[model samples]
Target: MAKNTVIGFLGSTLDASKRDSSRWQKWRPTIGLCMQQDLRVDRLILLHGEKHESLARFITQDIASVSPETSVEPHRINFDDAWDFEEVYTELLDFAQGFPFDPEHEDYLVHITTGTHVAQICLFLLTEARFIPGKLLQTQPRRGQPDPSGSWNAIDLDLSRYDSIAQRFAASSRESTSFLKGGIETRNAAFNTIIDEIEQVATRSSAPLLLMGPTGAGKSLLARRIYELKAEKHQLSGPFVEVNCATLKGDNAMSALFGHRKGAFTGAVADRAGLLRSADGGMLFLDEIGELGLDEQAMILRAIEEKRFLPMGSDKEASSKFQLIAGTNLNLIDAVASGAFRDDLFARLNLWTFHLPGLADRKEDIEPNIDYELERYAAAEDTRVTFNKEARERYLAFATGPNAIWSGNFRDLSASITRMATLSPDGRIDRKTVDMEVARLQRLWTSDRGDDDDTQLSAILGAERLTRIDPFDRAQLSEVVKVCRHSASLSAAGRDLFAVSRQSRSSTNDADRLRKYLMKFGLSFDEVRAR
Candidate 1:
């Protein structure tokens, strides 16, 4: 059997009596802890300060008289101020670091009943965190009992053993997860899992987090939620600062991010605290972080790592300790490969990278998020708008269908919902409203897809070649290329391109008109389709 070892402070007032004879009659907590009938304390590690040495020795001698089998070891732990939490905790941490803990061969008990309140709290924290390998031993005094040695109880540190406490913690965790997810009962298991993990890390650490996702995928909202949650826990006190890195350019980029001393540049009229400094003791959300300039990226890395940075045209370095949450839609790995982003900065933020899926990927969550968007719209516009059952079903069908390519992700859905809610005739969307919204979404998505023809046509004809062409011809040819790409054959493409004009002719060959149009740009249906 493992030997039992008890460790605690030598209580000054509780262990000392007015008279030598009275000390034996009073119930001293430390003495009673070792004198338990069923508990066998093989050794006692009694902690105390320099002033309590005499008390420590006297208690050791007394314990030797009563429990001869218990060997008392005096460990002097000094505290500058017994009540100072930091000092007490630091000293105890050092003691725990150097102490020879042999838990396999000996059972350890931390006697928390005898130390100062600060010391008791520190001891409890260390034991709970497992710095001290021991269970808490609390001894209480008996009022009228004959035995001066009162009752003692050992408390297990594993909180899961306590059902009520475990349930409370579990409920709190669920509430936190919901808060991080914007209170939407999202059905995406993977998304819920990511939010749960983010909640855990957000509450437990101050490390930099990198959120990678497509545009309008809720990166900024999630970052704000993280800040709010941290603030709720009193972890952050400063304001939440946010900046879209893409808008920063030239000298303004450096000035905007790291602040600028007066006369730093032509526009500098006064001292300005930058976003990082403004977010001191709080969170700074850097949206579109991948768009930041290389020079700015270098400064960001330094600021994040050292909490120190030189402001624009400043002689002295400034400091701003803040939590950084970087949001990016770009593939940073690819950006690094292209030398657009710094590798060192990527490595630093990569410590906690979470990829949020686009709306297209998490289609199952659309229903709940739709409800959320409606509720948000109602609050913002002060108009409660809802969709009838059939209207909702119709919207869901189109939103989740193959044609509904949500290129802008949640942003596209939000816009669609907003438009429908605003146009609702009776504060309730019927199938007629749903039909109009569906057509509007189709036209919106088609227009967006069609707008990319400029890039496609430019790639084929070269930027210079396309610029030389007349604006009217360029746009007309761009639409021709889009039609050709979508059609199965040249005749089918011609029919789409000249659908209106062909109706005016008695017998017109649509394929010939399209062929002639393609030839004007020195392109063919096959060539446009292939590109």
Candidate 2:
């Protein structure tokens, strides 16, 4: 028997023949026929169109009489009540999301009756949404009888139709594979070399890989692209599971990665499968790998090296075999030296490593990324928006300017473009709006930098230095002056020609030395302080 087949039944519930007792006489035989063929139906979802109270009651009674063993779940939906296209789509999406069909379990059977034009469209969208895989079991009105209930006989739907529907739906969901979708388009020489090496390593060995890069440098995106390319070329058969390790810190982290037995802990009232098991025979991406604690790191290493691990509190080992792709921003070498990370595990994962360059290093790609984002946001908003030549130039001028740090890299650029598109006046963005955004961002960025710098400076100056300075120490001091003229006050004269604020303090010893030197130059505290 085929393992993954979904049977869908489509008909109207309002037909008068359905209310007739004779209809059940015919439907009962069809149900018995299905049972005799050893077709095991676990559950049935009864979908009806708007305000068909009579039809709904008839369907409820008919399903009960025909298939008493099957659990029938009913969902009542109407599309005409929706305000707009997005609202209609969202309502349908919500319904699809509520499906209890498990991909690993028994096949789903969707029974749709009381068909309307909008209802048909919803069904089509549901298929394309890839929420469940099922075949249609539609009952059309029979000739001469002029009604489905009077003369209709249940017939198994064609599997080819279902397959065709699924293929088309999948295609619609993934409309394109290009740079616009955070996919690799034209590979640079360096990146191409890295990709080649990664492919070679992944093909030759089963060892996991560690991809190191700053945030928004496209580490996760690149990992997915690599998986797609490898799966296509090597015919690897499995799903790719990506998890952000940073979000999975502390105790909940372990159970999230590894399966847990029933009553393993407080929340483990029932047995739960972990992502690793779910990702079996596929790829598991652990992004922000550096955030993992030492103990969690050890557990991950064991799984990687041994291909097996004991779920929390389980004596029996669970075996999981899959390729690992780890990503992080920290320098593992430094982390290991500082005793913040496991050296052995680092070496194990470092067998194959790829470092993604920041967007600043690839300025050539910025314009293309911006253009792609513009088109993407426009499509998503269902608006016909475009950047004029002047606006594009203005955007680029500020993006590549000296003041642009863009520490968040591609994510920052994407967000900036989205804001411009949303806030553009008369569908046109100007330089003033761009400048205002930049300035606002700059102030926020500088404030964060100032806090970090102050902490570092205070640590270096020591508690004693901080106490005597009064309002003087709060002023910005040059790194060289802070180190060389450690004990001077603001009254220093001509020793260091660099401009010093009145609130600048060198150190007590430097202050005395500076005073003596200033006296020799016929300068005093009042004279230097006044200057």
Candidate 3:
């Protein structure tokens, strides 16, 4: 491998008048670099202006006297004004780009010690960005003693090995993930990983995020949380404006999202700043974006790409600089194929798409979410509710069981908790409350099945047996069958079912009694078990 080359601008310290017999009195940075025994500076590219030509020549000779092996090459660059950051940065960038670099054979070092602060910062940025594949070299002046030769150090700008920095990043990642989760301790590893990546993206990116999932799967909730995280991080300043695109109708959709001039439509009585404008410098969450009309889709495309759009009935364009987070339950790719959604808009938002899992898919998270829901209810109702140990377990068993059909995902869970908390006597949900809740959930799941043969009822009693059951007794029997399906055996189900009723009986034959009852419904252990 070839030795590294040092590049830096010549300072006034290289001038003959600034030179001294005692090197410690005024040790210039450039001289310090050449005198370093361990540094292998094969070639030095000294940048100089018209007035610094003499100084550059003197430095070259001085460097030769100190370190003869290092080759010095002076390059003159004109600057309209060195103090102007824009001019200096542009000139330096152009120079670095034009320079012939043999990356495989040579390494590069940018000496940041011998330039104006602006120039130093530009060089650091260039090196850090890898525009110039180099490390930054800094020279620290010695304060005391016989050695003012000073100390030289190189920085690569990558601090991956620093434990504090790594820990900080890990902590921030956890915090961001928690923010997106609404502080719920989500147990789904895949969902947590996705949230972690989203947090990282929210922290560093302004690109459009497309959250695709079924309704009630927390897409809207996660989008709002992302906006809040960005705001808290100081990445965004304006309000988080949200709009359900599915609710937007007719010409109002355009006016609501892209603003409208007065008289744009019959109902457009006044000029309006749309959701996009209101979200300026912040985040705009357009939920159910797949519901937008084609014209609105095209307008959204323009707004996302150009950050400008023409308002309805307006001749001029309006600008709104906002980060966008779009949500939808519809498959945009399918919609695009069907000519219902714009292909271009889908492509743009597809850059960072995350699919939130439904409640059924994340059963492990139900326990924590149950607590979260209860806490939310307490906050809203100003009454804390606690579930008895067995009540909580009973609820979780049914919730995470195969019989549960959470069509409404989190919405259903939240509603369930709200109802239980509202009705809990003395703020305590007992076994009776849990039983009622379970029965209600079963009814809901059964109703949601909508005459399907593969429903929880059919799965327990078999489709043929369900057809013979009376409509009046179907709801009551369905709950019984659900318990039977969850039990380890028919005897276990009978004992639990007749725990109170058996006390009225002179003799207890719970299993035999339950078998005879199931026989009345034309169902048997063999048939229900097969189902």
Choose the strongest candidate by lDDT: 1
lDDT of 3 by residue, 168-203 (tens): 988877787887899999889989988888888888
Q: List the global CA lDDT of all models.
A: 0.89, 0.63, 0.84
Please rank every candidate by TM-score, starting with the best: 3, 1, 2
Candidate 2, 208-310: lDDT as tens digits: 8899988988888777876775576574567899999889876689899887898888888888678888778778999988888898889889998888887
What clash pairs does model 3 have? none
lDDT of 1 by residue, 1-531 (tens): 999999899998899876577777889888887788999999999998899888888888889888999999999888779999999999999999999999999999999998899999999999999999989999988767766799999999999999999999999999999999989999999998999899999999999999999999999999999999999999999889999999999888898899999999998999988888888888999999999989999999999999999999899999998999999999999999999999999999999999999999998999999999999999999999999998998788877766566888999999989999989857998888877777666556646777576567766775434544665776778777878989999999989888998899999899988998889888888888887
TM-score, structure 1 vs. true: 0.80
> Quick one: how many clashes does candidate 2 have?
13
Candidate 1 residue 36 Cα shift, in angstroms, is 3.1
TM-score of 3: 0.81
* RMSD per model, one decimal: 9.0, 21.1, 8.7
Instruction: Choose 1 or 2, whichever is better by TM-score.
Output: 1
